[model samples]
Target: MVIRTKFMFRAGVTVLALSFSAPALTHPHVFAEARLDVNTDSNGNVASLHHVWRFDDLFSSTVLVEFDKNQDLALDQSELEEVGNVVHASLADFNYFQLVTHDGKDVPMQAPERLIADFVDNQLIILFESAPDSPLPLSGKVEFGVYDPTFYTAIDFVEDSYMTVNNLPAGCSSSVVRPDPDEALAQNQQSLTDAFFNDPTGNDMSKIFATRLELTCSKDS
Candidate 1:
């Protein structure tokens, strides 16, 4: 949904920007400030992830106007609910754009259990929770990242200190990284044309630009 929201919001700025030209897409159209609250169970296994996504003013202004069907100049409770429903439905296709991995293996996550949308200061802020399809041990290398595989929406960590882990094992700690694509990939995005946008299951280029959180825990002897 973040991806769709990104494109929709960007399209509002200029319709021609959708042409997908390399120079035109040099910078992402939509920017979202994001935070991840990782929670672990008593066994030191990850239980769930709470996410807060705040969209930029340009996008939010458009969304607020569109959703305020009554022309109240404010998104009422029903309007907010509509926003939540739409986001939840759209993001279902992207697995809510949340990715988790442990020791180089993908960690499947279930759909968001709940989504709350609110308009604040001309910005749209969404809060939701996602749990692993199955509990994942915090031991070894655990990582989490959120991004639109198609690169339509650029998700960023709002603050290094705000992306946090709660109840992690005693010896475990977390770190964050935002990686940039190599020169070759950067120079030639033609290979990453709109094909993947139609079917994101095939494109992972966005991961290269995603914000990654890594957790390391002590191993038992």
Candidate 2:
């Protein structure tokens, strides 16, 4: 059965564009499990961000119905490619749902050249690599997080092993930071006003609940 609920794709195929009341704006209509790998260059500078996102079954089923042109009940390679293309194009409007910073300054990321989509266990998986517009030297502190600023989709790093640093330099360590929901809400109450929900591109209030990855490298290293 084709699910014809209120779900609408905007930021990406996995994201839902809901027109719900302000009280319901905080709740996500879609969900995804994400795995991130920070790849470093030979000089130990961050080169690119690799992502593997597995969408929830309900959203995946909706995608299959929309993109499975043959009505064969299974997505073929070409069908999957079509899904990937749509997601890659749509995600650009939302910075691919990536948040990267160096020493508290925002780091710009280039659009991914391509995205690979696959279906497994009734879920849709997307894989892509996003590189910084310029090389980001591994110094001081670097932070990364995946989130839907509009709060239409909830992306979670469900496992400790889901976040990793590859080719990390010596004397550097990485850790995950899961914010306290109550504390975050209390601190950002003003930013979460009704205006925030109405404006999609308004201040990013989602950061308060984002699960972030922090990387610290010793200057001597």
Candidate 3:
């Protein structure tokens, strides 16, 4: 999972247009702050948990979240619970772990084993999965809340993946592995960050808004 702490990098896939109440999407300008991503394990289990809030994209926005596991991505058949600021979303209820089948067939979804969470640039991602290569098609729903972020002070939650996750660092150089792993990982991260944050030469932004994200079958795809 990939996440953006300051702002979200997505404006097309998750939410297309913004509310007039928010009005950022009326012109569809890029919002490169405050977002998250969640994926599944190779066996379709959620392997991580990541949350980031870019203080810059605020309309008194209380929170930005994605809910409704609405799919069969090997849920644990349990409800979600939260204690104070700490929230717990059951295995199947994560953002990207939502299971999608070829013809709506039930498959193996053991439960949430692990969660991979990250916040880079203006995006955030959380992935929960057990194994790898489980033939699980990614599908799920996300929710972003904007209660009163307009006035809230900026939050400091940006850090390196290794520093934040407390892992020993896999030391992957890039998303692509041909020659250099370290350089590649760094480049991949920077490239993704740049794409999400930097607007084109002629494009500019005025405001930011939050909305729903719907990813479903293409009907004929």
TM-scores for all predictions: 0.81, 0.85, 0.22
The per-candidate count of clashes, in order, stands at 0, 0, 62
Which candidate would rank higher by lDDT, 1 or 2? 2
Give the least accurate 10-residue stretch of model 1, judged by summed lDDT: 14-23
Ranking by TM-score: 2, 1, 3
Query: Each candidate: what lDDT?
Result: 0.74, 0.80, 0.27
Model 2, runs deviating above 4 Å:
1-24, 189-194, 197-201
* Residue-wise C-alpha lDDT for candidate 1, range 121-165, written one tens digit per residue: 889999999898887888888888888765556778977876789
On TM-score, the leading prediction is 2
- Residues 109-170 of candidate 3 have per-residue lDDT tens digits of 34444444433332333333332235433333212121112211222223222112212123
User: Any idea what lDDT model 1 has?
Assistant: 0.74
RMSD of 2: 4.9
